[model samples]
Target: MTLAGTLRPQYDCVVVGAGVLGLFTAHHLAQRLDPRRILVLDRGYLSAGASGRNGGGVRQQWEATATIRLAREAVAVYRRFPREFGYNPWFRQGGYLFLAFSEEEAGRLRKVSGVVRSEGLPVRWLEPHAIQRRVPALSTEGLVGATYLSSDGVIFPFPVLWGLYQDLRRRGVEVRTRTEVLGLSREGPQWSVGTSRGTVRTARVLNAAGGWSRDLSALAGLAVPNTPTRHEILATEPVKPFLDPMVVTLRRGLYLSQSMRGEIIGGFSLEHPGEGTSTMPSSSLFLREMSAQMARLFPPLASLRVLRSWAGFYDETPDGFPILGEDPRAPGFFHGNGFGGHGFMLAPAAAPRLASLLLGERTDLDDRLFGPGRFLGTKAARPVEGLTLG
Candidate 1:
């Protein structure tokens, strides 16, 4: 609702960061708890995080089973979002086409495809000629093979955020923007949270602070190894719809998709000169690298003019998996961060699971998989997810 300036004396749960994950988790929590007892605090206005800066690509072709399951669930939710949330996010299921440059990448896709098929999804392996015919403009010179899944798609992110925010407000959840969390301390079974506005007491607190999540954890005497990497993206001038599926190049992490409005939106990664910092500003190095890669893949893109460009942080971890579940050290505290660049896509599905964990309800996404304690202890060499793209 309004950017609430004052803080309530007490709350059942306080969710930090009003980004996509925070809003979605609060939405789920409101469904079970007294809506007024939950509060979402953010340091900036809505659409200020990676949720707004992303290319809006959603896919299920991931290396890990947990990640693929979460993405599959998100696609299903988006398919029914209009009926569930009364908002049309333009969930276009045009499909996602991933191009492989080497046999190593091709074999990885082949293996990951089996995991996806085991999850009951029809992921197809396509030859270079087939991929060329599917997208006539793409020049598949070094393309060894590709993967196609028609069910995986993209959505306009703003509608998802607005719809969730409005629906949460309708259910009486208090959302306070421009309210930054300053300090966190445990007072024996209760939490005393200090904020820029005022102090509030809440037994339960969920850190979905995104790129700043690790910093927030340290406030509560926890040292998380999450690092921030600045990534950039660009949008090309509108052209007649010529592409269908979102095209992805595994080599450079280059991905391009046409928006419903006809703009070619995409993102890519270059050598990071200064990563692990939270400052976000579009860089010339990124623009030069992205333009060259886009032109090399699809020569037609060479003529397209750049409309805009921007940057955001991907809160990455050593192993490329999101840190979820509650912290054992802090009894009532929980974490929903370390999602890297794909947080927006995973928000809808992961939020409900995180809410379940916060309420001590059993969920399929258990602590063993995504718990904040995953990186700790002698058994920390867990399975690593390798399909992390910027």
Candidate 2:
């Protein structure tokens, strides 16, 4: 909380990464502690990572009870984001329509529907005709069935970052972009975080670095079970508004939605795993596959010229869930990574709880549901979250 230096010699809590998850956690941390005591450091500028390059689909249908619960809260948070964060992310609750092209995927959706319904959210099992009724532009060629939750939504991802960044700055939370963490050494009860700027001491540290999380953990002399996979998305030139809900095909692992600006922004799953380096590269293979799938799904968009394309990394876990909370291997170091491609949606609900944990408060999810230690030994073979599009 010192005002004398450009980079302070000490902080009460130092958050690694300035992405949505990092900023959101710092925002909550500022609420309970002196904002001056919190420091947010990122190697790149805001929205330079996955936070900037995602199709903002927010849905509550998840395979795990914890994920569904978190997603349910995320929808509510986004609904009131403008009032809460002083910026409008243009969140639209037009619902999320998940289609199943095969009976295998159909069965998966049925199970997910049951799990979602059990969590106090209503989901409708729709036949192909019903799916067509929702978005008539969609072609039901290999469609089996689908599930729909009218409350599910999508948002503008950039403003969510700007809103949180603006709010954090206003609250005196120092978010230092282009300041990368070089090393993490245990200094008795505190952490000596060596950054590109300077070394700072902190009683607690949260690794919310997303894609670079595994590398960050290694800096602290700990091994984390998370992988970085590059996924690409494309935005077509604006057209007249047609699509209402975010449409996703389970068998194809592709999702698409119309932005408020009328550009159809969409992305699909690809397999490009990384080894702790920061590189986001777009691919012609992605364009070929996603474009072909998008046009085939909606015959009307067959001739729609693509305006631009980009890539981002999903910090994946073997089980498709995020690893949160402190690690046993390192005493004071904590983790907030491995949310994969869905962190933007889940961060709203998760950040506050993680901040509370950082401030030495016991929260409900500070346990095994998202714990960093959950992947130890026999627990490593956890159940995978099936509703994942990527």
Candidate 3:
């Protein structure tokens, strides 16, 4: 497993997580500097956090214009990720179907359809019959309509991580596993990171530590307004390939996507926000909620035997959107966490823009809305409504 020399206690940049955001930040930095100057430190195996554990749902149907843009751009990168990283990420372009149970929900989705079409995405509004035809097993009892995105799809999370990790290593970026970051300090123009393995110095640091990002910001004397809420997802026994597009019900906060292996994998939102980062055994309440919601939308899954379930934290923000860009208090320390539930779909697009900003390049995308200053005293200059993804 030794791909390069041991850490030398110093580097040009040190990223403190190997999750999607951290890996992409380090990879983007390596694109800007010598590979030897970049280092990625992770506390667990690559993709072991929310990155690998997430439901791998990628879609462009968002209420916020910025969220839409981020997701649209990320989809492009994800389409080309396999060739760029030399491994197919199993990114299936099966599209996404968003079902509505009420006229209000249907009307809101109709508006979102206009936004999606205006943004040049391949989305269309479908009546209940169309949804029933596309997904024969779904129950259309109370359903009114749906927003269908032909370009939306799901990817297996592990191969994407493998491709990113191997690609970074091949470029001479040092990634250390099982290396927990204990502390950090600023020294003149550089930052010193104290870890369980040893200390390392870097000119800049990116805090892409997924669920632990808020804690890392505190170490730099920055109060980040974020909380890690736990979400659980379960799989059903392998079945025939009946479901194609991912089925989502925004009203119920329910989403279900079938894996390549035919296991229907998904979950529903909790009534209250989750507590800490414990990914303990799945509870009966979770199964009950998921089963009830699934039956209400897709009646076919009601009898599907549950295979297994797992949990991961949703690093949530006040607005249920991500907080991206450089830290206002600590310029050299950057942040790219708090995607709420869509970090994986936004990382590819966000990473390159962040890299361009760090290197003083001009980007057409303005990221001030996502800066750390927004949470301090500045309110969101623009109002974002509809489908906040809980």
Candidate with the greatest lDDT versus the true structure: 1
Question: lDDT per prediction?
Answer: 0.88, 0.87, 0.81
Model 1 quality (TM-score):
0.97
Summarize candidate 1's per-residue lDDT along 95-129 as a digit string, tens digits: 89988899999998899899989989999999989
Kindly give the stretch of ten consecutive residues in candidate 2 with the minimal lDDT sum: 270-279
- What candidate 3 gets wrong by more than 4 Å, as runs, is 1-6, 271-274, 278-281, 360-362, 379-382
* For every candidate, C-alpha RMSD to the true structure in Å: 1.3, 2.0, 2.0
lDDT per residue for candidate 2 within 143-207, as digits (tens), equals 89889999988899999999999998899988888888999999789999998888999999999
Model 1, C-alpha of 39: deviation from truth (Å): 0.3
lDDT of 3 by residue, 258-296 (tens): 898999899878744545564444678898888788776
* TM values, all candidates: 0.97, 0.96, 0.94
Error of 2 at 11 (Å): 0.3
Please identify model 1 stretches exceeding 4 Å from their true place.
273-278
TM-score of predicted structure 3 = 0.94
Q: Rank the candidates by lDDT, best first.
A: 1, 2, 3
